[model samples]
Target: MSTKLNRIDLNLLVYLDALLRERNVTQAAHQLNLSQPAMSNGLRRLRDLFDDPLLVRTSDGMTPTERALELEPQVREVLMNIEQAVQPRSAFAPEQAQRVFRIMASDYAESTLLPAVLGKLRVQAPGLTLDIMTPSDVSFLDVERGKVDMVINRFDSMPQSFHQIHLWNDSFSCLLSPENPVLADFTLENYLQAKHIWVSKTGMGVGVGVDPDDVQRLGWVDSALARLGKKR
Candidate 1:
C-alpha cells in the first residue's frame, strides 16, 4: 500500500530521516538545502502530525525516544522503496555528484572526529565538499536552525523532533607541569596545594547560557577542590 496518501508530505519523511540521522535540525537543513527556520517549521509539523516529541536533547547530545526508534526501520524501508522506484541506482558516484555537507562541533570534537571522517571522505567522496563550524555559546539550536550542521557534545536533555547519533563518549582528567617540585610524588595533598590555572567562562550560569557539561565539569572541579581544602 502506498503511504503517500492521507495529506501526508513525503518530503517530511525525508526531513525526518535526516533529522534522525543528524540529530539536529540545522544539520538536516544543510542536508536538505533548506533554512534553519524552515527546518524548524518542518519539525513543528512533524511533531504535531505524529503527536510525538521524536527527539530530545541530553547533556551529551540528542537522543531518540522509544516512539522514534520504533518508527525508524519502517520509515527507512518506505524511503528506500521510493528511492529505488525513482532512481534504480545503487552506487553513490561522488565524482559526478555535487554533494556538500556542513558539520558543527566543539573544538574537542573536531580534534577527535574530523580527522577520521575527513580521511574517509577523501577516499570515498573526493568530489564532495565539507564545511565545518566549531560551535560557540553551545547553542545546538543553531544546528537545528540550519545555521550550523551536526553538533557534537556530551549527551543531555533535548526536545523531541530532532535526531541524534552517539558517536562516542568522553571523560575529564587533570594535568600538571613536569617541573613542579610537588612532582616528588603524585599525592592528594600535592594536588590540593598546587596552583591551578582555572579556565571558565564567567558570564553564564549552570544551564542557561553555558553548556551543561562545562557547568557540570566546573562544579565537579569545585567540589573536588573543596574535599582537599583548595580554593579556585
Candidate 2:
C-alpha cells in the first residue's frame, strides 16, 4: 500500500481527478468549490506526496508528467468506487424531489430537445421548479461553477469535468427561395458566391458568420496518424 494513499484524505482524489482534467488551477478549484489558493495548497500537498511535478506548464496548457499519467486511471477508479460505496441505490422519484434544476442551452436546443424533457418533468415532477437560461459564451463555465445544474449545447466547448450524453445528431440542409437570382441547379461555386443574411447567437442579423455546428461538421478530417493506426 502507498503511504501517500493512506495518509492523504481519500476524498481529495475527487479534486485530483478534476484538477487533471481541467489542467488549470483556477478552473479545477472552481469545479471543486474551493478557492484558487486553497486548491493550490491541496495541489502542493499532492505534489510533495507524489514526489513529481504532476502538471508541467507549457505554452498551450499543462501537460501531465509520466508519473501523473500512470496514477490517473487509479485515481479515477478509486474516486468512482468511493462515490458508489456511499451513494444510495434508490431510484430518483421525481415527484418526491422538490429540487429546482437550472439548465443553460442554446435557443435551438431549447426549441428542439427541452420541450420533451420539460414535458416528462411536468408529468413526473410537478413539485420541481425549472429555470432555463439562454446560452452564452461562458455556459460551460457556469456548469463548472455549479451555477447551473445542467446544460445542452455544442459539444466542442464542453469541458471534460462534466459527463455528457449524446442526445442526437441533426443534419443541415441548404434552403433557397424560388425567386432567388441563382439557378435552380446551384453548383458549389454559385452557392459560395451567394450572399445571405447571417443569424447571430444574440438573435441579431449579421454580414455572415459560420455557426459552430457547421464548423464542426465541415472540419472533421481525422489525423493522418490516427488513420494509419486504424489501418494497422
Candidate 3:
C-alpha cells in the first residue's frame, strides 16, 4: 500500500474523496470545478492505481465498492490533516475566498435558518457555496469524518471533541383548523382525544423503538405529554 501511494498523485486522493461522497462523476466534477471528461480521466487513473472499480454505475446511481468504502476514512483524514497544516490562522477573507461549506441540518432548520444564512452569504461571501443536506442518523459521523462542516440540531449532549454554541432557543406552536369545534375550548382533554400524526426521523415500522440519542429531538412533544402524565 505504501509503495502504491508513492506512485500515485496526491491530487487523485482529493478527486477520489469527492467522487466517493457524491457518487456521480458530473456532480463530483462540479464540486471540484473540473470538466466532466477530466473527472472521467481521473477516475480511470484511480481505477488503474487502486486496481479496482472504486465506483460502479447502477440504475440508481454511482455506488462505491467495498474497497472505496474502506478507504473513505483514511482519505478524509489525510486531506483534513493537510488542510489544517497549511491553513492560515489569521482572519478569513470570505469575499475573496472560493470555498464550499457543507452543512447537515434538520428540515425545520433548512426552511428557517438556512435562508438567513444564504442572505448573509450573498452579501458577505459571493464566491462561497453552501451545500445544505438533511440530517440523517449518520450526520454526526459525517461531521466527525470532516464530510460535513457543520450540523444544526438539538442535542441532549454535544460531542466532547466538537466546538458547540447555543444557536437559538426554539419553541413549538400548535396549529388547528379554523372551523374546528375544539378551537373554542382547547384543553388538555381535547388535546388528548385528538388523533395525532408524528413524523419520525427513523422512518415507519411496526414496533421499532426510538434510539436514546433521539430523545432530545422529541423534547417539545415530550414536554407537553409529560404535563399530562402521558408518553409518546
**TM-scores of the candidates in the order shown:** 0.47, 0.56, 0.55
Sorting all predicted structures by TM-score, with the top scorer first, yields 2, 3, 1
Q: Could you list the CA RMSD of all candidates, in the order they appear?
A: 9.6, 8.2, 7.2
lDDT of 2 at 67: 91
For candidate 2, give the lDDT of residue 94.
83
lDDT of 1 by residue, 84-148 (tens): 79995678776666767777666778888889988987887788787776555546545444445
lDDT against the true structure, each candidate:
0.73, 0.71, 0.81
Q: 29, model 2: CA deviation in Å?
A: 14
lDDT of 2 by residue, 1-232 (tens): 8974578876567667877878898999998899999888888878887888888899989888989877876786577678889999999888899878888887878899878888998888988887888875444545654568888776655545568898888865667788887767687557656774454555533223534334332332212223443210
Q: lDDT-based ranking, best first?
A: 3, 1, 2
lDDT of 3: 0.81
The best candidate in terms of lDDT: 3
Per-residue error at 2 for model 2, in Å?
A: 1.0
CA lDDT for candidate 2? 0.71
For model 1, where is the 10-residue window of minimal lDDT? Answer: 138-147
Report clash pairs, candidate 2: none
